[model samples]
Target: MKEDIENTSDSLKETRNVFIGAKVTPTQKEHIKSLAGQCGMTVSDYILSRAYNFKPKARLTKEEAALLQNLDDCRSDLVKYISALHGMSTKQRMVMFN
Candidate 1:
């Protein structure tokens, strides 16, 4: 999806003069806008992504992304640490985790 975003922007950045208009009820417009907002996309982006068969994911805040990366690093470290505890029983491992 990230790659798709970059590619789409690169391909269309200087050539986005064509308009693709559609008629919808005011209620429908609001609903579409709400859906776009929920995914951190503009209405046009939400529509384009959907049209291109890409599943939209919620955009993350910078802080949230950093925290997730940190958590992943910690989990990797924990796996390495656990492997070094070769004498520990499986039961001990489970109990310790709990």
Candidate 2:
């Protein structure tokens, strides 16, 4: 019995040490619970996967997909603008700063 107790104490020490708490609305709690269930994971596991960028084959909703596309488009436009500026001669570039 003493050996079993010692083993249990050692096991507990090997487990995670961090704790986090958040105050979420009931709706938010339900949403997170549902998502965790869909992934066959506990809420902690689901949150950990997301927080660590684990890419668990999660699917984005249509709105999220659209927003991501818009962000990509904006990035592409910025790249093109920067490239255009980079290709200009120094005098031509300086003209715009005046």
Candidate 3:
């Protein structure tokens, strides 16, 4: 179908599926990892962002970091609750709503 073909093309555009490998000294690897940590990104993500000419933002403050962690926990809890809802019968769901 044309729709299926278009969907595949759109998905391909959305993802970077290419792999780039490099050789680096242990010290260099550590430095790159440290920089990535400061940007709150994985080493690979940091490298890719830099390669694409994107500037990495400064690290978050302790309070900001704590808030982000709490937000992540809340998001996880919400996902679990939604998944549980999917297993409920219609009557049970109506009971829940009421």
Candidate 4:
């Protein structure tokens, strides 16, 4: 009977809620609940939305930011090298990257 009801609902494109269990610290639970309340969503809804559209938060430490800046400099240097050798044949470009 439950399966028949589920099939009928699926045919109608109606949705039902599903639940899963997760373990987290009390503080984490409180935070999620607070944020979800602000958006008028349940914690589960907020978490599912976040999982579906994950965007990384900026978490750069000072040292990590400096390292990224150094890598950016290296990327700029490589671009300049490639442009300077515009007339170098494809083979030369491949060799330069290698």
For model 2, which pairs clash?
none
| Clashes per candidate (backbone, < 3 Å) | 0, 0, 0, 0
Q: What stretches of model 4 exceed 4 Å from their correct place?
A: 1-14, 54-98
lDDT of model number 4: 0.77
TM-score, each model? 0.48, 0.42, 0.47, 0.38
lDDT string for model 3 (5-96, tens) is 55886788866577899999999999999999998999998997787578999699899989999999999999999999999999999999
Candidate 4: Cα lDDT at 51: 68
TM-score order of candidates, top first: 1, 3, 2, 4
Off by over 4 Å in 2: 1-57
Predicted structure with the largest TM-score when compared to the true one: 1
Between candidates 1 and 2, which one is better according to lDDT? 1
The candidate that wins on lDDT is 3
lDDT, candidate 4, 1-98, per-residue tens: 75686578769997646767899999999988877776667777678667656432435667988999999999999999868799799898899889
Runs in model 3 deviating more than 4 A are 1-13, 63-98
**Candidate 1: which stretches are off by over 4 Å?**
1-14, 59-98
Q: Give lDDT tens digits, candidate 2, residues 56-85.
A: 655676798899999999999999999999
Better of 1 and 4 by TM-score: 1
